[model samples]
Target: MDYESLYKLIPKEPKKWLTQDVISWLQFIGLGQMEQKFVECSIDGAVLEDLTEKDLDEELGITQRIIKRKLLNWVNHGLKEYNEYIKQMKMPNLNNKKQQDEDFTIQKNIANSQFEQMLIENHENNGNDQFTSSVVRQEEQAIKQEIPGFNKFEHQLILQPIEGQQSNFYCVREAGAKIGRHSSNQILILEENISRFHAEIIFQDSMFALKDIGSTTGTFIKILKSLTLIQGMLIELGSNQFSVQKLDLLDNGGIEISLFVVEGPNLEDTIIFQLNKDKPSVALGRKSTVDISFPEDHHLSNQHAKFYLVDQTVTIEDHGSTNGSWMRLSGEGKMSNLFYLDPNEEIIIRIGTTNQYICQQNKMKVNEISGENLCIICVERERDCLILPCKHNATCLKCSKNLALCPFCRVKIQETIRIYKN
Candidate 1:
């Protein structure tokens, strides 16, 4: 039969019927296996009034002869059932309607009674005003309690890359934050040198502190000098003995004492320094007073290069060294003679033929190092000093003294004691 003839055979209600109803009719007609194909046809709008038998045959993947005969029988049966249902809905018995109205009213009264009972129970529970007031007061007191050192403004950890002129800032929002290669950690370091769960920055006892969580490489902070204001003057008694008893008064009132002079490494040495907020700028070369001195190298100038932090960005600029300074960026196999670094990248500093330093935002784990004996900074010198706080024995005495921060964890080194073999 044609689509127009088949469509006219179906009742309007059956045309609006669901897929399940169509499936039921298909099963009743002994065509249950073909139900899925018919449902697909319906989804493609094949059940519409404009649908043709040719369209159904192509969509249902069934022959026109079989489908036409099956659909005609299904439609005839559905039309009879649809007409009877419509007639019953339109002419419901008056006796049944009255009975339904009465049943609805009774249900409404029962619901009202249940609602009133719930209200009475709620009122009884709230009658204990004293208990409620005490609970509210306790909550208020807890809110007012002061927590020391948790000044939101100061509680921030910044990871500044030594090579690249980029930094990552993390707000101390929670009690602690984990930093590592693990996906679960708040701060992720994807470098293979970092452990899965490397370290944690915790806010405890009103202080934001960094702790190394048994990482292969340790954590480090930049060492800063503790500044103290002294009111008294100093007297030069003997070489090592300074007698504060003999007060030397100045014209301005009290004389300030200069107990010791903190000097940079000697010119002939290779120094490793960490870039931090307080001391951001560092000069490297043959000068003894340079932040990072390379005194013995003739290829280096009096001031070879400068590594400084500008607004949290670490940048290195060559200062006219005779042999010239070069940098190799992260992931690069060969060292390039690049003058500047890209963002979020690591660079190896090379002066002459020696790889002077590896500049990066984060420290590499000890296990990530190919050799244990080599210094972490120079990579050429034998390691002899064990950095304190995060005890990773990774640098020689010369490199350790010059380092304000540990190369492994980037944490400030409190002290670096020399380790001697017996």
Candidate 2:
């Protein structure tokens, strides 16, 4: 009647572990339903009749042999995966130069196929060929991309106030988040106070913008890390959505602040959305979602490629971290270790040391934005210019002074190169 040992046998960390117990549990009871009941029953104990294997197979109309085989296969696979995880943990720390190289080789060999599958999936979702017609737009907007290790979901804030208690809610962009205004570094303005409020914010997909609505006491804005205030007056994000702030008018009025949680899709989902907009098919960097029937090991290291479709042109930039990123333009086979990317261009990101793990990317045309030929970066209009170091393109005078890098690709430049047209 003691299932504690069986539960303890399940590894704490199983990134690559199989879900045999989960499957068996599902068969005995049901998914999402009766989970607590089954856990209680398992604690008391599980009976063959209580397992519901036959009934489940009948409901699913599956043969008894298939269910039994699948269950057995999952158990075996789970054991193997758990053992591998243990083996990895027991290995010596790979830190020294030589050890690092060896670790990179080993890890890459193990993680390569998964990486390549991600790339292939990315390419299938978004290909570079789609950008053949559109010129790169100078006007800037926030877009999302699938970054590894980072959370790719949106978060919202929910505020609740206790009745008759007064509470104040102050909302600003988190620390480390950059802020800019009309080509100038400015502070965000706040609307006066209110009693209760709720607002939504997001950081995934490379977007770097925020908005505040009219509130009772007013909301203040500042950069995430620095004390630098964003320039200009306060502006709400969307036409319809309003920023919120709370003010205590009477007694016992306080609010509970909660964040909106957007659950991420399974690794099997090829295209990950950064915002609430339409999404394109994107390839995985080093992982792919295959038909569940096929073993995951089959497509592990071979498919590490990616691609995305955008309104005008696509851009890629190196994050200026430890490992250097590389690219293969148009499948040329020769990889270039440089920064920045454009439409129709294919790239491979060399992550970590020695470039053992590579993430490839291409462009696709399915979700093309309207107005491919329209170029927004010019000197004439009331355009906002983003300044950079090398001075490749001359952006609007307003836009240039506010940015520290080329807004198109975020490439850092040394000098403030300002080239205006006559």
Each candidate: RMSD to true structure?
Answer: 33.5, 26.4
Per-residue accuracy of model 2 over 1-422 as CA lDDT, tens digit each: 12332233332232221223343445432243434543432211112223345533543343557555554443446434545665664567757443354323432432343244445555676856533211122111112112232212222111111111222111111221211221222221122222123111233333322222222222222111111111111211111111112111222222211111111122122221221114322322223362111124322222222222233222122211111122211111222222222212221221111112111111111112322111223223432222322223324455456446553334554334322111
For candidate 2, the lDDT comes to 0.27
lDDT of each: 0.43, 0.27
Candidate 1 segments whose C-alpha is farther than 4 A from its true place:
1-168, 223-422
> Residue 18 CA error for candidate 2 (Å)?
12
Candidate 1 per-residue C-alpha lDDT over 334-386 given as tens digits, one digit per residue, 9 for 90 to 100: 21121222213322332112212232222222221134346645546776676
In candidate 1, residue 19 scores what lDDT?
Answer: 45
Candidate 2 lands at a TM-score of 0.18
Top model by lDDT, which number? 1
- Give per-residue lDDT, candidate 1, residue 68: 71
Worst 10 residues of 2 by lDDT: 222-231
